[model samples]
Target chain A: MFFIGWLVIIKNQKGKSWIKLVESKEIIEIFFHGRGGQTAITASQLLAEMAYEKGFIDTIAIPIIGAERRGAPIMAFTKISEKKQIRTYDSVKEPDYMIIFDTSLLDIPRIKDTIKEGVIIIANSPIPIDTTDFPDNVKIYIVDATGICIKREFMHSSGPILNIPMLGAFGKVTGYYDLEIMEKVLKKEFGEKKVEKNMIVATDAYESVKEV
Target chain B: MSKARKDFTQEQETKIIKGNVSAAYAAKSARVQVIGAYPITPQTTVVEKLSEFVDSGSMPGTQYIKVESEHSAMASMVGASMTGTRTFTATSGQGLFYMNEMLHWATGTRLPIVTAIASRGPAPPWNIWADFTDVISQRDTGWMCSFCATHQEIYDEILMSYKVCEDYEILLPKFVAYGGFILSHTSKPVIIEDQEAVDNYLPPLPDEKGWPHIFMDPERPMMFGNLIMPSGFYSEFRLKIHDAHMKAKEKIKNAAKEFEKSFGRNYGNGLTQQYKMNDAEVGMLIYGDLALQMEEAVDLVREEGYKVGMVKLRYFRPFPVEDIINIAKSVKVLGVMDRATAFGSPTGGPVSSEVKTAIEGVEKTAKILPMIGGLGGREVTLEQQTEQLKILIKMNETGDAPGDLFHGTLWHGKLEVE
Candidate 1:
């Protein structure tokens, strides 16, 4: 039973406890932008599982599905809350964080325009992004998630499996979870055989990710 | 910490799973004997995962059937159901439309078949996205159609549907519907109950004796579903289907109550669940994925010190007329929101029209603001839902209607094509 053990905030009202819990703190919304083959959607889900495993009261992973081809740009969002149930399934607009799987996605206007003031950006790039057009006071962390995946031999059929390392970098950047939490979730999702390789790439990005 | 171990027989497992996966797990938990499947967008993964479960020998007791089309998929389910086995299948949008005739065949034969619907918009702009037009279009088919507001509810409701649908008093087919991509594709934390807990909650799987309703054995051979003339039991049978739907309301509520007692999840009497409606003067009646968001919308609206509430319409076929009427009477104004369209209907939205019909002659009824939006997987934000509640409050304060009322219904969130 997910969150059944977490009955810390019990509201004995005529309305009930779930609604009362959902009305607590503002939810932490993270948006992920990636091309179709890149596994941004899985990154979103994995991030949710990791956060929830690390004791976030509630979380949801929403992927915007479309007629996507291999190279077509796709989007997903993960909303995790510290003390509240995530009732809304809407895609994040004014996101607290953005995970960019490719640097070239910023060239697309729709993706670029969502970079709001004071938002933190974690992009999978080997170098600092051109931030001449980025909003003021925005924090950006750059990780060579692709580079780490290749070095660790985390090659899926399409390319490097980007989500595992990307989420590993995310855990380090946000401090919402750690490599241990990622290990627990990855072992659960990918199982023991696949978890070793996945964690190898994950630890690479976890140790190497830095603010630009 | 080791919660996601491969073994599933003992302890309950909680995992972040797609809604389609939840439905598939529900079928596995229910010990469904047969699956008739045809792949469609948004619904493909459900049958795909069920096939995986069957192929991997995890569900060795189950039989998986791959059919060419949605019609054959349901036709196979009807045939399987006749043999008195717990049968399941899933389809969406055009696939549901293709299975229309068999949908009636499943219900009219009084089979306890359960189908998961990743509801999508009807085709011809050739759309395959979230919309309830497909399931609601099966209104006359006599299947008990229910909507799920959360990912967990998709699993809970399917298990509950079996209890209600398999009841001798209401041996009817059912559709557990949710928004296609909005729910079906999205992943969320869902609690997968252990086999022991599920078996304890649900009725025992029919023994080798087959289902008692229509047990087909070589020793006890009997013909079923023979053609009936106009003067025959045709009219009686039709009346009995309607009678069972009316009775299903109570059975659904009981199942929800027992589920809460057994599994500790509350679904507000199963037909319609309410949030903060007791002290509210205005409320919103909604269903499917949007209703979960509206709870947040209601909480946000309540933070501003306005009396607002919400009700998620859980079951559509039973209609839950008494509950709808009670909700209407308790509020000063009620907004009926629909994520599916109903062209030429009185309210221009399916559920809103039903709400109107439900309270037609009710005394001192609340003003109903009929609304339709979020169709074809359109994004209806929390702010938009909060705005709709504000519109209802304003409608209560001042007797003026909002602008751009097509046939006196609000067609909200349409793009401005200048």
Candidate 2:
């Protein structure tokens, strides 16, 4: 809901910092909704890292930590700014983008209420979601993040490790960070050993994501 | 058998980290000799990260002891500090309350043990969230207390705390507190300064001779903190503690200045930092996480034609009396906000009470407004803060107060329970 119009200093393929003034540096707040064990918390952090890696001046990852159990609803938010320092630890009220890790969470009243006007939704569902009651200008993108994870056997003890693929799909939709940045961030966070498997699901979700 | 220690080559890098992790990294950067750890929410990650660093040999030769309770944690740090080593510990809420007895002991014994408090609301209703009452209640403990409004400040202030606390003149323990969950759990980009730079900024570890006041050599026997009679010099020692704190104000300022010079991050004059206070009619004094959020509120309201400003109270113990007086003189109405409770106090908030005391009898100062909000992790949104600013401006204009004032103090954002 805030405006952040500024330049982005991303590194070129030649390994030099290339400062490019973004024409539409539209401000974006990413609201992440998922159940516990779905890795939505990690997804928010990964998104912030990818954005910062691709040269956003300020970023904050806020996970609403409270009585979280394996199947209970969990929420997080990532605020990315190019021109201004992102202050305020408060959760995003009107999100420009909502990354829904579980499609069923859409049925929850609180989650449904958050799908405000002019918002773009990136949902992890194999099929299109019902957007009949959504506010005007609400755009929905679909990616089979769990399917990709299951096909690649990329999962933790609880369930699918969906954050990587979801973020990959996010990169495709938003053009914030590409697979190269994702690979680099993944390598840094999970170390080199786990990067290969992570990128498998990540590349799948990135290529297969489509607007609905 | 001690395993071969890995040679750590710590390079400065800017990474997104939580406030607790920043504290841990600061302790590592300062090369603390001893760490006594007891896990509690919010503050748990601090010692957890340090333990990881010690285990990985990144913090080589650091003695990390896992104690049973928060009391023993402080007790062990006190014992470790007696040996003239730089000691560190962390706790929150009840964990801090349990260390009350030893907290007084740490200050009384004149040990420079620095502890980080991820401030949380004291529980009867079982709350583990951001509140300053945990550290503010330790007021009479004689230990210096500071608040960090940002994650990076957690790192910077911990390093500065050591410099000020370990000074030969001010050998007093201190607490560096930040809002739990709000600052503690949230992630932000914090620059972990180069080890060499941190080493240069902090005081060198104490020599084998120990502190000048007390020596623990078997040949030179000495007794400390024994029973003192009514005529004993206990009162004088207490007075000296007060003197040391008053003297530390200058040292804290110098340390902040030097830190800014070395690291390129400025934290006001070390005690309080004001934003857009010059040529302002109304101002808000805030601390912890709320202070940073209030800045955005100030900006939003400013764009809408209100000339409001804010001052962040960085240090609470040495009260920043002069800074408070100067700020009061600059504005017509100064609103002091607290994220902590002082149940029976005149203003119903800790910092508000102190601000009143600081500016008492000061001619032509601003009228005081005490406010308490965001306790127990309740969100203080930008919208609400903006509204608060408008209220302050109205107060300055017509001496009007918010209708929600509970006994002359604004209790903002209390939901209807019925």
Which of the numbered candidates is closest to the native, going by highest TM-score? 2
Give the per-residue lDDT digits (tens) of candidate 2, residues B303-388: 66789999999999888899999999999999999999988998999999989988999999998889989988788887678767
* Candidate 2 residue pairs in backbone clash: none
Residue A145 local lDDT, model 1: 91
- Kindly report the fnat of each predicted structure, to 2 decimals: 0.75, 0.62
Docking band of candidate 2: acceptable
Q: Candidate 2: where are CA atoms >4 Å away?
A: A1-26, B1-7, B214-221
Tell me the tens digit of each residue's lDDT in model 1 across B1-418.
0232124353588978999999999998888889998999989999999999989877766789989999999999998888778899999999999999998998888899999999999987878888899999999999999999999999999999999998888989999999998999998889999888887887554643545557666677778788888889998989999999999999999999999998999999899999999999999999999999999888877977899999999999999999999999999999999999888888889999999999999899999999989888888888678778878988888977777777899877777678
Candidate 1 lDDT, A1-212, residue by residue in tens: 12332212322212243232333235888999999899999899999999999998889999999899997999999999888788998888778899999989999988899898878999999999999888899999999999988887888889989998889888998899999999999888878998888888888999999998
Instruction: TM-score each candidate.
Output: 0.94, 0.95
Candidate 1 runs further than 4 Å off: A1-25, B1-10, B205-213
